[model samples]
Target: MFEAVIWDFGGVLTSSPFEAFARFEAERGLPADIIRRTNTVNHLENAWAKFERAEVDIETFDRLFAQESLALGAEVRGKDILPLLAGDLRPEMVEALRRIRAKFKTGCITNNLPANAIGSAGGRTLYIAEVMALFDHVIESAKIGLRKPDSKIYRMMVDALSVDPAACIYLDDLGVNLKPAREMGMTTIKVVSARQALAELEAATGLSLR
Candidate 1:
């Protein structure tokens, strides 16, 4: 049985942040494709990786992001970029997490930018408090200076949880990010939907759901 569970925050916890970005783009009259293109530089995951590693701080990252947008012929600002990071907690996922926490040590590993840069909206502080408090540990890329798809952060989570990688089940919304965890011998789940993920977790761990 897995002794611990590690979860990625974005797509797995709630709706993908990309949906928020799409809404933001439409509201601002910016090209919808610009956000996707910016994310793809050095591969679609590198921008977050660099931010999480502290190789680029928030101010510099914002300036560079704005420059890239302009270079790509889109008019966008740093403030306009904030919604891309907003997280919406899913009720079913929250319930599932509560159940998982009861049965296994649980933690979250996410690539997040500085909170100050993103600012607050929709009662975000409360939202963060509710979701983050659910975990035994939370390793944020911005705070920890490490981001995933990178193996180092995964190792860090394993170490922080005081569990063997083989004893942990790691869940991420992206196959690319989950690949490294799977390689390290952690049971991995690619979350497609809350219900599907819950069913998979039940199957893997023999933990009954409510």
Candidate 2:
């Protein structure tokens, strides 16, 4: 029923950054969800959102995030954790991308940092290059001055793909990002696991990844 498949990169295609954050937290004796809390401190207006929108450079994000962490009683620096966020990729998601590319238009809607140039999202250039080759169109927030869960970026994806929102199936690990797609009439899949997501995709699109 869908003409296109839309995906989120970090938590969906690659292993979740939250996993790394939890590990880092465990190793450091810090509070759980501290990193996410720091990023979500101001919600959409947080430094992470600003960084994704390309409003602030990496150095600025590091300083801003460090300050946010300090406000929460953690002295962690954003720079120290940035390099470790390149999560190991899921081969299944890559396979699903290729499998669906043959029949349906595929796009990647990711909230990524500017290229490894500014030290934000450090060590991500090669991985981004690898994934970019797989998509028909890549909507990266850093390049376009927009980010997901904003609803407008989702519209931007629709315009770029030239597809009706109703004819697209959107997938993201975060419920917040998926909510707008559902409101826009696209079928939304909360990607809790690759097996669960691919099963839903097979059932919805009849493109079997198994």
Candidate 3:
């Protein structure tokens, strides 16, 4: 029933950076979820959103994010958080992507920082280059000046893949991002864990993805 399988890169294919955020908060004695709260406060217009869209440079984001986090309570530099965003990749998810790609078109939509923004190639570039080669198409927020939960970006992927929305399966870790695709007539999966996501993908695609 699906011609394309679209994925969100951060949480779905890699270990959630939220876990890293939690550890950072614990280490600093800040309240839990402070980082997440800072990002979701203004949602679309927040410092995090602007950074993802490449609307601001690293220096600007560092200042803006510090101010935003301070307003919420603790002050956290954006530069510090940039390192946390590079989550370790999940091998099972990558394997499933390989299996699925052999049978269906595969695409990736990632809300990411500009290349080298992390200040260390080891964090993202090395593994990222290898995994990115698996995708038939990739849309990055920094490259396209568009981010998730935007209907237009989803439409761009469908058009790029030349597939009907109704015949595509989309997976994301965020409900806000999944909502747009779900509304676009695609089967949407909110990835909570690799095992759970693969089970659902197997059911949806009739493939033995483990």
Candidate 4:
């Protein structure tokens, strides 16, 4: 039986940020595809991994992003990049997390930028805090100097929770992020939708959700 549940914060708990990015880019007179492409590149180096790991500060990140945008032949600015981080909480997912917490040791495993800049960057801390309160532990990548898809971060979580890898179920929106966790022997769930994810959880743990 799975004794613990580790959830990714952005896509799993909330609506995907890509939606916000599309809207934001549309308003900025830039093609949504350009913004999306820029964001894709940003994710590879600047956003989640580096920020979560504290490898780069907000200023450095902004500079790097601007440079990347210029390199891509776009005029994207830091202000424009903010909307890419917006998130909305899904009530069903929040309730499901609560239910999971009541029955199993629960944790938040998120790749996030620094806490101070989250609000300005369109990151939702208040919403995150509400859902995170339900968890036994919260691991933010920035504070730990490790990011997702890295075996080290997964190991860190397993050690911190004191749970065997095989006894934990790790849910992430990104399949790549879940790869290392699954390799570490943790039960992995790729969260495509709140309903489907919850159903998977129910099957994995035999916890009926009414």
Top candidate, metric TM-score: 3
Compared with the true structure, all predictions reach lDDT values of 0.80, 0.86, 0.93, 0.78
Worst ten-residue run, lDDT, model 1?
A: 43-52
What TM-score does model 4 achieve against the real structure? 0.86
TM-score of each: 0.87, 0.92, 0.97, 0.86
Candidate 2, which segments miss by more than 4 Å at Cα?
A: 117-128
Which candidate leads the pack in lDDT?
3
What lDDT does candidate 3 reach at residue 210?
77
Decoy 2 TM-score against native:
0.92
The lDDT of model 1 is: 0.80
Q: How many Å off is the CA of 193 in candidate 2?
A: 1.3
* Alpha-carbon RMSD, each predicted model: 2.4, 2.3, 1.2, 2.7
Decide which is better by lDDT, 2 or 4. Answer: 2
Q: Per-residue lDDT for 22-128 in model 3, tens only?
A: 99999999989999999999899999999999999999999999999999998999899898987888999999999999999999999989878976554556677
Give the 10-residue window scoring lowest on summed lDDT in candidate 3. Answer: 118-127
As a whole number from 0 to 100, the lDDT of residue 210 in candidate 1 is 48
Q: Which of the two, 3 or 4, has more lDDT?
A: 3
100, model 1: CA deviation in Å? 0.8
Which residue pairs of candidate 2 clash?
Answer: none
Give, for candidate 2, the lowest lDDT window spanning 10 residues.
Answer: 117-126
- Give the per-residue lDDT digits (tens) of candidate 4, residues 1-210: 788999898888888877777777678777656655765674656543565688877777677667777677776765456656757788888888878888888888888777666564344566666778898888888788777777888888888889999999999988888999999899999998888998998899897754
